[model samples]
Target: MFGPEGPSLRELAVQALSSVEHGYDLLAPKFDRTPFRTPGAVLDAVAGALAPAGPFGDGLDLCCGTGAGTELLTGLCHRSVTGVDFSAGMLEVARRRVRPAGGPGVAWVRGDARALPFTAAFDLVVSFGAFGHFLPGELPGLFRQVRSVLRPGGRFAFPVFAPPRPARAAFWTLLGFDAAMRVRNALWRPPFVMYYRTFRLGEVLGGLRDAGFGVELYPLPEFGWRADGSPRARLVAARRLTPRPAA
Candidate 1:
């Protein structure tokens, strides 16, 4: 258990045994109390980074579990904000919990991210701490889904933290977690697929390019730089390229 309000260790074990959707459903109520929720600091940094290009029209928060990113969108987007996720339980919680004053209208939709429901609708799309649920092979399709919903020249953005150095204890911790997950999935039915190391930055940029995005990366100076002098966190801003006019 993380704390009195957080899920007990037994609940986490049960959730780990369940499929991703069902597991999230079971955890949705106490999810924010757990360490898994995206931190407010991260959300604030993202909002600050995005404010310059924004006051965007419509926005979509992909896989918007409990509306952390969706809440941030209210301040950035001008017209409307939508949060979509496959878990109804999460959406229910998001609907009741997130209510920002004097911003864009908000809506919660339950749907799969890979096969998104809209086409060319939103001016901006953002996801946070959700990429690890997807496998590496799913990146192309996932990026395409994000691009498809974006208006011409619309942006799809997310933050990626610098991976821990190999020598660091954090690195081994993540490695061990991934290894345990692999073994768990290998033995369990309806696998809970969450792996931290699979989503590499280079592969993601390439996937965005293949999906017709003009990708850019901006350092989030709030997190400071790593020992190698690279940023500790960077926001990936992949804009959907406008189609050329017919000659």
Candidate 2:
């Protein structure tokens, strides 16, 4: 329902009723046309933010939907780039659209993020617009999975926008959407499992810490600041800790 090129209302209804993986499988062809795709502006800002920290060896785009974040990795990583997701349909679309002309070789892997199929293989990892699918309690295990796939001192990065205030319509809109999803899941089989408000910043940071990451937040100046002077958006860069030499 995002545009002429986007999914129709009926299509969206069908998707909403399906399991998460199957829903995206149904939507994958037109997913980029939907507002659900990460915006180019945000991707550009994240690329700019990550440039100095990279020229990385190999990279992974965790939960790499239609490959927006995977495309971002092409310029930053030197060796090779891989996109992993649970949806075969999404991976098919990504394979067609995310070809890099002269940069690192790109590969698409179909696998769940919670059970990634790689070891300490990536020098960098990035994810965008996929966390809402994860429940709050899943963060610790999720972060640990991300950490497990990163080499010593490797970084897992993603951008987070400031949550809208209660006075704002956006806040209520997200709240209502999450509430509706809860009700839908309660009544439906094979729950869709997406919630807008579950990934609180404090909880995320704590989970990253518990996963043994040394975290840093960098303000994304492209989005400006809130009235309270905090950044409107921030990049969360969580680095995997290298093991100390044996005593």
Q: Candidate 2's residue-wise lDDT over 155-211, tens digit each?
A: 999999999999999999999999999999999988998888888899899899889
Write down the TM-score of every candidate. Answer: 0.98, 0.98
Q: Each candidate: what lDDT?
A: 0.94, 0.94
Query: Where does candidate 2 stray beyond 4 Å?
Result: 245-247
Clash pairs, model 2 backbone: none
List runs of model 1 lying over 4 Å from the truth.
245-247
Q: Tell me the lDDT of candidate 2.
A: 0.94
TM-score of 2: 0.98
lDDT of 1: 0.94
lDDT value, residue 154 of candidate 1: 95
Question: RMSD in angstroms, all models?
Answer: 1.1, 0.9
